[model samples]
Target: MKRIPQCDNTLGPLDFSKMHTVLVDVDVFNCGAGPIPQDGRDVWHNDFVKMPFSLSSYMKTGYTKQTNTVRWEVIYKQLRSLSKKTTASVKDLEDAIIKYNPKYKGQWSFDALSSLVKADPNGSNYSPKLFQKIAELALRLPELVKKAVPLLKRGHPAAITLSQTQIACLLANAFFCTYPHRNFSGPKAEYHNYPSINFTSLFGNASSRKKQKLRAIMHYFQEVTAKKLTGLVTFERRCLKETDLPNWRSSNKKMHKLHVASYGTIENEGKGMLQVDFASSWIGGGVLGSGLVQEEILFIINPELIVSRLFTEKLGDKECLIVTGSQQFSNYSGFGDTFEWKDPHEERLNRDEWARLQRQIVAIDALPFKHRSEQYNMNDVTRELNKAYCGFKGHQSNEPDIATGNWGCGAFNGDKQLKAVIQLMAAAQAKRGLAFFTFEDESLKQGLQQTYHLLVTERTTVDKLYSLLQNYCATQQAYGSAHVDLFELIRINFSPSKSLL
Candidate 1:
């Protein structure tokens, strides 16, 4: 029988004209992500989809596939050990590798492992098994590591470089590919946003145009080889200053750094004015109740202690500032107002207890200001300041002689407001260093104890939120790119002084 070519209108060896256009649709259920056949359910006919392929496809296919089961198990075990706060050393890496496969324990010499990679005669070829694992694990490991270590300081040299190394290592290990060379200006390389690697150079040989394009794309974006790693070193170098990185325990008096952040009040009257008098009108006692006196209290009590804090090796150097700002206060009474002539109760707070409570209140005076002045120092400031006294402007003829509840009993209002402020201050202080007990008064002590826990809890929540936003933006590619929006996910870490204040 002779084979005949098909014609438009006649059925022969092949004919489409007589075939009916039937839209055979099948809803793909738990099958992995792949191109749908005309009939759809021929999924089993195709090779099983990759783990990530299946997971990503689930959003569209409504598939609940048990993909990544083995990979995740391995990754989770590695991460569980890696999550320790202690610095990861070469020993740790060696230990992990030894455990990964016992057969390689004695044979895995560092130089031997390094030399195992061969120059491909046909260009940089990668093992199929390695490439698949690298691409799959790359998407998941960072997320897990981020959870275990929430704060990654870019200023730390090791920290700044670690992200790039991790990305490169994961990809290389998975693909069994030679690590990309580091030559920033090479022809085949293009730098992206990463600031950790010194210079990444990706290479491609005589492959098909599409393959070359894929290689370029992978190196430029997916792989860590096409990013500027040394840019971070430049950034850190630019940030260094005289006040940063000093020996704290040094006996040299001239080099002794003062780290205080506060304002100077020359007037003796405001020295013991007490922060309780500064609560705003909403609290009725105004300035006295507002924890607005924090800065003043720190200065009056001991300025040097605060100054010593900011002048540390870890903190980048910044100029000291002298603040001259208004410190609001609420007026309780004057010469014409009634004054208490005697004690109201037989059981009175002892002098020591009263002093202790007063100290606690004073310690909290700087809380509000800390919220705003974190990046700079405010201590050297000589604030020619004034007090805003809040109360009723005029008196009515029908009004009772005694102050109304709306006006707020000055003493009670002052105490409550002071308590809230001190609580915040104590909590902030605790985060910076070991905190001291200042609440000696029974009443103030109770208030401090109750509010302290609340403030601490709130601080933790806010820190987490800020970190999430910061990390998101840092990890994600800049807007208008094909990369994941991982950078935008980070929350900004708040400076204890500025945001809270």
Candidate 2:
């Protein structure tokens, strides 16, 4: 079998200077940096959290006829009973989850959980032990996260940074479906725009893919519960207001460095660089459901990121989410339907000043096109450019260069060549270098490298490329069904005219 390629060291070096990031404190880079204040106008929305640390927290116990009680105190009795059990069945686990989430009783299914347990129902690794550990972790949510978690609401440029332990505890709660008011989703739902949080959807869908997803998630609980976890992870929602967006029609920026390769992947080869996630408008697109594409795969491996769905609002077109210091727990082979969960990934990365792993990821969703020609419309092209720019633009001068490739080309029905050029232009405008990963597509690797060479040789500026795109869009519309290669057109436009002696 062919070995995995090495591209992490090739992407670029890490700059240790104090680059301005989305950290709450400008100077201090720790979770303990400052006091997390309550809702101060447009800053934070702590009004929604029902956890013990929030003002909205209340106790309800048998006040009416000594029967109605909403206290979590009553909820812990069932969780503790399940945790102490040495031979709990999948049925017992489901019963316990439903006891706490009574509203979802008879509504949520547990087929996936039952199927996973049956695979090794009596084994040392599966069943009783694994199921029990998950309950214990879920029970510790209130104790672990003593501070209220603010919803990373819409139209707000804000962040919520939590320690790895806090993230693990939160995910454990999601696994047991303990979050309140999060199960409902629709037009009138409180968080109608956000992705589903509870793991009910994941637990109900029984398939080989679901089994693999459970393996990764279960492994995370085993590791975190058995050992001491460290480091901080942050989720920042960045919005590019209309005025902050670049005037793509007239910009004089030039492309920086380019390293195109057909081998290696974004997470592997692109390590330590600003990795780009080809995400959906709803972050972690269908991770807890039937979908298993790029975005879903990303969230599964790094379960820490799955916690974002609990608070992050649905992303806007001009917005992106930057995750700093998330650790990859498992590695896998295959893409889409062929995906399989490989073994554990030893955390070899060094920690930063704030105890976060030396890792950064930016999530940017591209337009999903039904018909390929729809992307060539100038309005659509402009939107794509701005979306890429929103993710690529540097928060500070010392940021690492970007590592990406074929961003919206897979299930989104995007043209690979056009997507590549859009990213190039966005990277150039952002003034950062780029390392393009072709995911073993040699042809794309060659095409991208040649295009980069031509663009650099002629010293093509961003505005020049923008003008070329305008003409290409017009050509594509006029030609109708005929396909035009974007790179070939660039060569024709950049090639020096025959010298007339």
Candidate 3:
């Protein structure tokens, strides 16, 4: 890490060129091997009908040999009738969904939805009206998917651009359970890797947590259908080949620029920078089910991102999803069970060359360790290194640095010190800087800064850091009763009195 001279608080930004600097050798990083070869079978063919969202496409629907049996006329007529109503009851919505998805009539549950409406702050006043609006919007799914490019799973670069209105329409369909063959589960299930696109999960297994989530989701529908959103959003899935992976064990790059803060969130403080979403491979994670953490919080506030679940397959370790131009439609307070929908947000960000919003978020799911000890193995460490590197590696030199913090540290129970070092090394290998938000963890802020300073002073290479991790892991196992602190282990190994002095 190169340090530039600073100016007074009242002065303008510091001039970096004028500052004294130490040059260190830069190492080229590579991940061994290329992406795994796929069989001739296409993953999309296993799950999707390859049907585009269009009125004509749905108009001719009949019982085909396909798993999903949707009668387009039946759906259109039911939605059309619901659209005419100023208010709709829970039973009416259930009947409409059953009309289209007769297969799950008895199996499906709506306890959560019923609870939500009953627990509504405004009582029946909002539930009936909101259900009516969602039903009406869902009727327009044909129009929404009319131009939606099919996101095939062919391991190639592709993007789907759609408006907020289009997203709302699709979500409304999700609410009505219009998507067929999506309700089953098993190793042989067609859409196993994909998160449940239908709202069935949210409506079943009623609990206080479910009620709160419905509030946020219902609020999202209320806003979108109330006004047609005017911006375009694009979801791009980027797959990295073995040629693109870095040789992590031999990287010679020093740490890049870093900014650590004890306060402020990645979304607010790291604006204009590429934000990292600590996600589950299944995309929305347990959001629809019963899990909420950093990833779920992000999806709830920027609900448009949830639509990605419809097309995105489970992310491979070498792959990540880059969402651009998705607008924030609502503001919220708290996390998990405490979460609440606050107010409608007005997005003013400018669009980019692709007509997408300037906002960019990269979704990378870290390995969820059931036991803390499971993450200390070398193979596990390498997997995480590759995962973070895959997301942090930049395609263009001009791309903004990453804005991330406590990536897998929350519910995933990751060690913050280990994750921070992994991200630092990955970012360094990619020649990009980082803006890490400690999420108000003061101790982590100071510990990371001190450890980073020591590594820089030692001119430590990534290989050296990796070697140190090996020793630390061994020590942790040997001393089974107590866990070793990573920064402390490094300090003891490279003490100034023993080495630098």
Give residue 7's lDDT in candidate 2 (0 to 100). Answer: 24
By TM-score, who's the top model here? Answer: 2
Report the lDDT tens digits of candidate 3 across residue range 70-182. 36667777877877877777878888878767777798889888877876736422555787788778876554454323543535555565556667777788788776557
Cα TM-score per model = 0.16, 0.88, 0.84
Query: lDDT (0-100) at residue 356 of candidate 3?
Result: 55
| Candidate 2 similarity to native, TM-score | 0.88
Which clashing pairs does model 2 show? none
lDDT of 2: 0.78
Q: lDDT (0-100) at residue 141 of candidate 1?
A: 35
Q: What TM value does model 3 have? A: 0.84
Per-model lDDT? 0.23, 0.78, 0.72
When 1 and 2 are scored with TM-score, the better candidate is 2
Better of 1 and 3 by lDDT: 3
